[model samples]
Target: MTKRDIFISLALMCLWGFNFSAIKLGAMQTDPILLTALRFTFAVFPAIFFVRRPPEAIRYLIAYGIVFGLGVWGMMVWSINLGVSAGMAGLLMNMSIIPSLAIGYFLLKEHLTPYKILGAALAIAGLLASITITDGSVPLKALPLTLIAALSWSLMSFVVKQSKTKHVFAFSVWGMFFALFPLVLFVFIFNGTQPFIDLPSQLNSEVWFSILFQAYPTTLLGYWVWNRLTIKYPLSTMAPFTLLTPIFGLIGSIIFFHEDVSVLKLLAFALILSGLAISQWRPKKVEITSAKLKSECK
Candidate 1:
């Protein structure tokens, strides 16, 4: 990767990292479900009017939207609001790679290497370590919800890989469109019209800034650039940069939320990252199925 590309990757990582702090700020002012709905609202409208829809099945688009938007993010924001620390949430979310790899093995018949198994074991052990952190700082109840979020993200990633969509950004936009309605319905069902009615008055500048930042920079810009990079470079070359996300996540949490970083938390972070690194290991001559297509730098 060129220095410019490296800079872009670092910027994307920072955006994602700070996103946890942004979500935490927004959660303070609005109901998590409602905040989620509003974020997608900005993600979908205006831009969707300009960006062409992806040439994929409507069912797939809807499924991606539901799984990625509702299942993953809804659960994530709720868990954070329920007291899951932003840094821990970011670290736990990385577990999505495990399920994604598993799905690839079962469905895509991708080679299930011994390294992956070892990595999975290490990750599980790390998860166990995370559970033992009974330091009253971490919320035990929110962990399951965050895990569910990661599981949903894994499923979403599988769908994206299977679709083999050429226009990833378009897919993201349309997916957000489809996701918006369900999120709206969720807000209505759970929080009802009261939050919506009071939303404008309730929102302070910081909360509004969080919502806008999440919608534009975090969702639209972040995914667009990320997908484009994946197209331009090999997954192996790009995937490692993602490891930086949790690191920045932890730093951002400490800076913004002043969250405590315990010893066990540090161990869990190290082990999980090590597992991710191991899982990403591929033979030098190995060809990735997804990279079969030639890259088109537009």
Candidate 2:
């Protein structure tokens, strides 16, 4: 990648990392479901005028929207509310990569190399270690909810991979539109009568700033840039950069939330990073040729 590409990747990582902090801020003042609904509502506004729908199967687009927007964000917000620290949430969410790879292998029939298998095992082990070190005492009873979020994300990845649409931003925008109704229902079911009617006014400037930051930079702009990057580069090349997001989340948490980072957690982080690197590392040219020949012969 060029220096410019590297800079863009770094900026993307920063945006995602800071997103945890933003979630924390939003959760403090508004109900999680309501907050999630509002975030998407904000995201959909600009796209209404600018983004065009792709000429593809409507089902794929709708499924993508549901999984990516409503399902993932719904569970994630609930998890954050339940007691998953923003930093921890960021770290644990990396677990979605496992399911994504699994889905690709089983459902999509994509190749899974030994390196990827080993990397996945190591990453999972690291996650287990983190859970154990934290005494499995997830706050707000958030583990299950977060796991749902992870699954949603994995499913969304599959949806994106299967989408016939070439325009990523358009898919993202349509996703927001599709998700709005479900998110509204969720908010109604959870928030009841005393909704975030006062949320706008009650939120201090810092919180509102966090909300707008999340809606625009993290949701809209970040997705736009990410879609472009994915189009320009191979998935393997782009996948590793995702690991950087959690690093930013950790740093941001320590700085903003004053979260503790124990030695074990640090060790877990190292193992996870190593696992991700190993998974994404390309094999030698000869090995690639051999694999290709073998597949063709089969």
Among all candidates shown, the one with the greatest TM-score: 2
* Model 1: per-residue Cα lDDT over 182-262, one tens digit each: 888988898778988988887899889888998999999987787677656544345445656777888899999888878
Q: Could you estimate the TM-score for every candidate?
A: 0.84, 0.88
Under the 3 Å rule for N, CA and C atoms, how many clashes does model 2 have?
Answer: 3
Candidate 1: C-alpha RMSD after superposition: 5.3
True lDDT of residue 93, candidate 1 = 75
Best by lDDT: 1
Q: Write the per-residue lDDT of candidate 2 for residues 1-298, one digit (tens) a residue.
A: 5679868987998889889888888787777777777788888887668877777688987887688677788888778877777778877777777777777678867777787777777777877787778743367468878888777877776677677458888887887788888877877776665775766675787667767887899989987787677556544445556766777887888898888889998898788788877876666897789999999999
Off by over 4 Å in 1: 1-11, 227-244, 282-298
Each candidate's number of clashing pairs is: 0, 3
Model 1's lDDT to the true fold? 0.78
* List of clashing residue pairs for candidate 1: none
Please give the RMSD to the true structure for each candidate, in Å: 5.3, 3.7
